[model samples]
Target: MHVAEEQKPAKKSSKVKWIILLLVLLLLAGGGAGAYWWFFLRQPPAQAEQAATEADKNATKGAGKTDTAKSEGRLTTLPPFLVNLADPAGRRYLKLSMDVEVNAPAAVKEIEGQTAKVRDAIILLLSGKSYTELAAPEGKLLLKNEVADRLNQILGAPRVTRVYFTEFVIQ
Candidate 1:
């Protein structure tokens, strides 16, 4: 009878130890899941918001610069010129009509004030060109740059940004 009584208590102790271990494991798993959620998943959203704010600030600065450029006046046209050819035949010529766009109001006023000088300079430049030189794309670009430079020199500033060809004919 005494042996049986001791064996019964030993079995009850083993069962209690197993139940305690299972409860401890469950608690540890739940804690680890909670830590992962707090540290990794929840932190990136704030960082993303900061990045968005910085992008908006840069966009606003760019918009301001564009607005300032718009407030300045513009020039739409310059007088046309007829350029004779430099070839040995000397029979071909080009008629060039271009428009100049200026960004500065004072520079536009300056160009308007000295129209005769500008016209003379353009005539001199065009009279020296040839038909073959004026027909190519590279030649056209070079001519535009030269015209813009001459206009800027007369205006005394880097006011002209582009020169557009309204008419170009070779004969």
Candidate 2:
């Protein structure tokens, strides 16, 4: 009975020692990880800039071309559209002048070639809108987006990035 009682305390001490050792190892590992992160992972601004430049060089080398989307797109002015807006009294008229931002300069010739179709589409779109619908800023923005979307459909691609309302008047 006496020996058994003594061995029980020995066994408890061994388990306690193991637990303490495991905890110490875990703490050391965490400290090492924090130090590594502080020293290596935290980059200075200059190093970050160099890394970005290196990545850009690598990307350019792989692509062998500049990005088209970042390019300064060309603008094309469409002929003015004098359309009759839909109204309950049937006397509303809208004169709208627009310029389109085309992604490629070559698209200007394409747009000029399809000028009749573009004009017809815009005329139909504008003539369908009632005076009240064209009265609000939201309505004007909607009109711009709709025009861009339709023109993109004509090109079968998103060649138009933006639409400008150079002139908008309703009478």
Candidate 3:
């Protein structure tokens, strides 16, 4: 009977220990989630406002996109551009076809109205890059971003959301 009583106490103590361990684990998980929310999920106020503005633009009519895509934006295809790379050793060229995503119909009209200036800017930008500068995937992304940034500046707003290199060939 004494041995039985002692065993009961031991079992109760072990259960308490187990409950404590489970609580600690739960606390750790909750803290991790909180940190993730703070660090990764939260956006700066300026960026949040920008995103909200873009969403408003997307919801407007005459965005030139299907239902699903119009919820985000629209794409406008640029004429294919072929430029000789700044290769000194030999002749190297890049033929690139691209599309730009615009925020709204006003942006599209602005882009269309400045097609000549846009093309000239792109041609100058592309013709300055050598084959080595554009051979890698990262290089292409940088080029796309630069074009978007430049176009946005010329258009006097953040109208261009993204640039797509639909076709890229180097020789």
The lDDT leader among the candidates is 2
User: 1-171, model 1: which lDDT tens digit per residue?
Assistant: 999999999999999999999999999999999999888777587887987876766697778844333633476677777767676788887787888888876777778789999988887877778766777999999999998899888887888888889998889
The residue-level lDDT of candidate 3 at 24 comes to 100
Top TM-score model: 2
Residue 106, model 2: lDDT of: 77
Which wins on TM-score, candidate 1 or candidate 3? 3
Q: Write the per-residue lDDT of candidate 2 for residues 102-150, one digit (tens) a residue.
A: 9988788889999988999999999999988989999999999999999
Ranking the candidates on lDDT from highest down gives 2, 3, 1
TM-score of 1: 0.57
Tell me the TM-score of each prediction against the true structure.
0.57, 0.60, 0.59
Candidate 3 stretches greater than 4 Å from native: 1-71
Q: Model 1, which residues run further than 4 Å from truth?
A: 1-66, 69-73
How does model 1 fare in lDDT?
0.81
* Candidate 2: C-alpha RMSD after superposition: 12.0
Clash count list over all predictions: 0, 0, 0
RMSD, candidate 1, Å: 16.9
Q: What TM-score does structure 2 among the candidates reach?
A: 0.60
Tens-digit lDDT string for candidate 3 (1-171) = 989999998999999999999999999999999999989999989999999987876776457755556546688999999999999975899999999999897888788889999999999999999888899888998999999988998898899999998999998
